[model samples]
Target: MAHPRQADLAGLIDALQAEGVEFIVVGGASAVLHGALAMTQDLDVVHRLTPENVARLATVLEGLDAFVREPAQRRLRPQAAHLSSGGQLNLLTSLGPLDLLGRLHDGRGYDELLAHSEVLTDGIHQVRVVDLPTLIEIKTTAGRAKDRIVVPMLLALLRERERH
Candidate 1:
C-alpha cells in the first residue's frame, strides 16, 4: 500500500501523549527535534513494556488504524501481545509510518533511556525526546551507512548546542 509522502509526526505524538502512553521519541525524529537537518519518514518511539502501557499502546495503534507494514496484503493489526514483546514493530498507520520499539539497537528501553531524555513542550503537547548525546551514541553504535552518515551532522549539532 502506498503511504503518505510524509509522516504526520506531530499527530502521532499527540495521539500517544493523549493516550498517556509511556514512550520516548528516538531516532531521526528525535535528532530533528534537537536541531539536526536529518530527515525521517517515520516516528520511532521506545515504549515502556509494562502491561498497562502495552494495552494503551495497543489502543492507540488500533485507533490510528495501524497494521504491520510488511506483508501489505495481510494488514495484520498489532495486538497487546505484540507490544509486550521486546522488539520492534514497523507499522503503517493513518498518520504514516510509526515504528514502536521495545528497545534500541543497543538494548536500551524506555526506563533505561528515560533519565537521558527531556520532556519538551511546543506550547501544546509535552513529549519526551531522547537527548542528542544518546541519539548520537545509538546511531553511531548501529554503524549502518545511513546511521553513519548522520553522526557527523548530529555531532555538529551537539557542539553547536554546547556553545550556547
Candidate 2:
C-alpha cells in the first residue's frame, strides 16, 4: 500500500468544494485554519449526510483515488452506502489523508455544527470551517491526550482573536 507521503489539505478542500460536497472542516484542520499553531496529518471534515451530498462526496473521493487506510492488505474503497452510514471513514488518497466524519464524538452532526461554522474564501474557493469556540469545545469534550495538548493553544488564539 502506498502511504500518502505529504497531505495536500488545501487541495483536498478544493476538491471537495469543487464537487459541491457539503462538509464542515473540523478537528485540527479547523484549528489551523483559525490560526492556531496546531499540526494535523489529515483533513478532518463532518459531512452532510444527505443523499445529494453523499453522492458528491463519493465522486470527489473517487477522483482522489481514496481507499480505506486500515488493514493495509485489504485496501477497501468506500461506497455511497458507507459514506451515508453516519460513521467515520479514514481514507488515504492521492492528495493526502482525509477523515470523513458523519458526526462528532459529542453527537453533533453537520446540521448541528453548521450554525457554529464560518465560511472562509481564498479568492477561488469558499470553505466552511468550525469556529474556534466550537472547536475548543469539541477538543475539550474529546478528552484525548492530543486534543488536551492543543486546547490551551486554541484558547490563547481565541483570546487573541477576541482582542483584535
Leading candidate by lDDT = 2
Stretches off by above 4 angstroms in model 2 are 1-5
Residue-level lDDT of model 1, residues 36-112, one tens digit each, is 78899999999999999999999898888899988867999898888998899999998999999998878889999
Q: Against the true structure, what is each candidate's TM-score?
A: 0.94, 0.94
- The digit string of per-residue lDDT tens for model 2 on 79-112 reads 9988998889999999889999999887889999
TM-score of 2: 0.94
Candidate 2's displacement at residue 106, Å, is 1.4
The CA lDDT at 22 in model 1 is 95
After superposition, the stretches of candidate 1 with alpha carbons farther than 4 Å from their true spots are: 1-5
